[model samples]
Target: MRPTVHDIAAAAGVSLATVDRVLNQRPGVRRITREKVETAIREIGYVRDVAAANLAKGRTYPLVFILPASDNSFMHGLHAEIREAMIRSPSERTSIRTVEVAAFDPAALVTALEKLADERPAGIALVATDAPEVVAAVDRLVADGIPVVTLVSDLTGSRRHHYAGVDNIAAGRTAARLLGRFLGDAKGEVAVLAGSMLVRDHRERLEGFAALMAQEFPKLSILPVLEGRDDPELAHMLVADVLSKHERVIGVYSLGAGNRGLVRALKARASSRPLTVVAHELTVHTRAALIDGTIDAILNQNAGHEVRSAIRVLKAKADGLAVIDAQERIRLDIFLKDNLP
Candidate 1:
């Protein structure tokens, strides 16, 4: 049988109230008394019943998530996930709030973080752009004992506690291998479209794609990366410009969002040319495009899974509990026309 708090208190020669105070880190306990209670806890192998403790304390985890205000399908999906969480929040004792800021704006994100810090939420989650100011802001939040989890995109060398997202570098390598195999030894240019280099995910994807292309598909040349800021109109204009300049473009890879614009450009330029198109995310537009042969392959990250994982981590941290690492892993989902889910 597991040892109870009364058993630990008796063993430590301390009162039940003292044991409770020491275990919960509450005030009015001497350092020596705390050390004695801790030693007794370890000796008796006392594990706090987290659910019972939470019930007794009536704890409600307050969390904030910051997302980009881009009109892209990926951001929309993320927002939908947050809405779903909000729906289920009441029963879970979790209070979650979302803040949207301009995409790729580090100053605005920092300001949002500062505002969240002022409010003193128990935890924060954000889709981070790689910026020193944003990293510092997150570090400050951490220093103040608030758990910060990076969602979708990560900030390197930051004090963020956890990252709930797929491995973008591996996703890019997979895309490259798929594209290379689909275009069997075809010596043509592949047009690349990205959201922004400031985002670590996009930059990592570009690196992985370039590395694979140099190593395996030396016959194919990757054109200069077109930055669309994850905007559909900008992506369409960039694809059109690239197609007009390079008639030998046999493939296109969109490492970020904006598949709506990609599909538009592809349908407009379909002149008996078998171009292999690969993109990220499985949105309504991308799904339709895949079925109609506008897109050949899609490398996707489940937005719902990412958001859920972020919330779970935040709640666990707020309760000062260890999370199940395996359960919190975000996986990359590959989709094709035949296997669309």
Candidate 2:
């Protein structure tokens, strides 16, 4: 049986109130009494159940989710999942809120983080813009004893307590393998679409995808990445221009959001030529694109699962408890035209 405060009190020959004060670091306990309680705790090995105690006391964790205010299907879906979590906040003993910043703007993200550092919520989850300043801000929050989790897009070098996102580099490498195999020894220029190089996830995906392509599929040359800024209209314009200019392009890798733009562009320039397409995120746009033969494959990570994992990890970190690493790992999901789900 696990030792409790009662056991510690009994071992220390002290009252329950004195043990509670020592455990919670509350005042009014003398130095010697605190030392005796500490000695008893060390001897009995009493482990406090933070969650259970918080529940017993009706403690509410105030958590904030920081997201980019982008007009894309995936971002919309992620926001929706956060809202659903908020709906269940009362039962979960949490107070959840969201803060939207400009997409791909490091200064705005830094400002938001600075403001949050002042408020000092119980925990924070953010879709990080991977800039140096943003990393510094996250480090400051961690130094201030605030537990932070990166959601969807992670800042790897920062002192974030956890990442509630998929292995993006692996996802990119998988996309390359799938795209290369789908094309099957065909030699042509491949067009890649991305949101921005500012975010760590996009940069890592592009890096992994490019590395694998160069190593395994040397025949298919990748064109310069088109930064569509995750804007549907911008993506549409960029893709259409590329298709019109690069006649040798035979494969497309939509490695970021704004697939609707890519889809519209591809459909407008549909031809008999074998142009294989692989994308990220299983959204309404990508689903329809896959069904209509515009997208051949999709690599997805569950937004709902990511949100829940972030919450769990943040809560555990705030309580100074170790989380089960396996339980928090976000798995990648692959969807093809034949296995649409």
Candidate 3:
């Protein structure tokens, strides 16, 4: 039989009220008393059933998710996952609020975060922009005892509790290696498309791609990175213009969203031999392009998994519990034409 609070109190030679205070992490218990209760708990191997305890206390975590307001499939999918979680809120006992700010706007993101902080939610999960203002806001939240998790894109030099995203630099390196292998010994230029430099994910991917290209494939020249802002029309126009300007371009690496624009541009050049195209995210457009041999490879991060992981981490931090590191680690998924799921 498992030991109960009664056993813990008796073993610690403490009153039932003191045992409750220590167990629930309530204040007023002295350090020595708390240690005594903790020692007793360990001796009896008292494993807390968090689910049962939450149910008993009727505790519901209030969490906020801040996302970019871009018309990208990946963002839509993330919002969908958050909605799905809200549907299961009854059992999970979580109230989620989503706020969408202008994409790639550091000032706007900072303002949104400040407003959310005003409400003082239990936790906040956001796709952070790499800016001093944003970092300061995150640090403020941490100082105020509100746990914050950086999702998808991370903010450096901030007091964020956790980051629920893939290793973006590694993802970029993988994309570069795949492109190099696919276009072996090709003497042509490669065009890189990204959302914005403010985003850490896009910057890290560009860094990795540039590093690998310089080191492994020095023969191939890379064009200036075009900022599409993750907008479909912007990406399409930029890609078309770059293709026209650089006639020898034989490879394209899109390390951000806006594949719809890329698809249109590549399809327009159907008469020419297909370029070795690589992109991020396995969206509807990219998936179709892969099947039709338009995109050679895709490096993807599951936005659904990222959103859910952020929720779990925020909840665990709010409750002052240790999270299962392996469970919270998000993996980068690679997809090919043959494996279209």
Candidate 3 per-residue C-alpha lDDT over 1-341 given as tens digits, one digit per residue, 9 for 90 to 100: 98889999999999999998997899999999999999999999988777578879999999999999999888988899999989987888899989999999999999998998889998999999899999999999999999999999988789999999999999999999999999999888999999999899999999999999999998888999999999999999999998888888999999999899988999988677669999999988899999998898999998888988998999888877888999989998889998777
Query: Each prediction's TM-score against the native?
Result: 0.94, 0.97, 0.92
Pairs with steric clashes in candidate 1: none
Give the Å shift of residue 83 in candidate 1. Answer: 0.6
**Candidate 1 lDDT, 128-241, residue by residue in tens:** 999999999999999999999999888979989899999888988999999999999799999999999999999999999999988999999999999999999999999888
Give the candidate number with the greatest lDDT. Answer: 2
True lDDT of residue 154, candidate 3: 86
Candidate 3, run of 10 with poorest lDDT:
46-55
Please, what is the whole-model Cα lDDT of each candidate in the order they appear?
0.92, 0.93, 0.91
Residue 12 of model 3 has an lDDT of 97
Candidate 2 achieves a global lDDT of 0.93
Whole-structure CA lDDT of model 1 = 0.92
105: Cα error in model 1, Å: 0.6
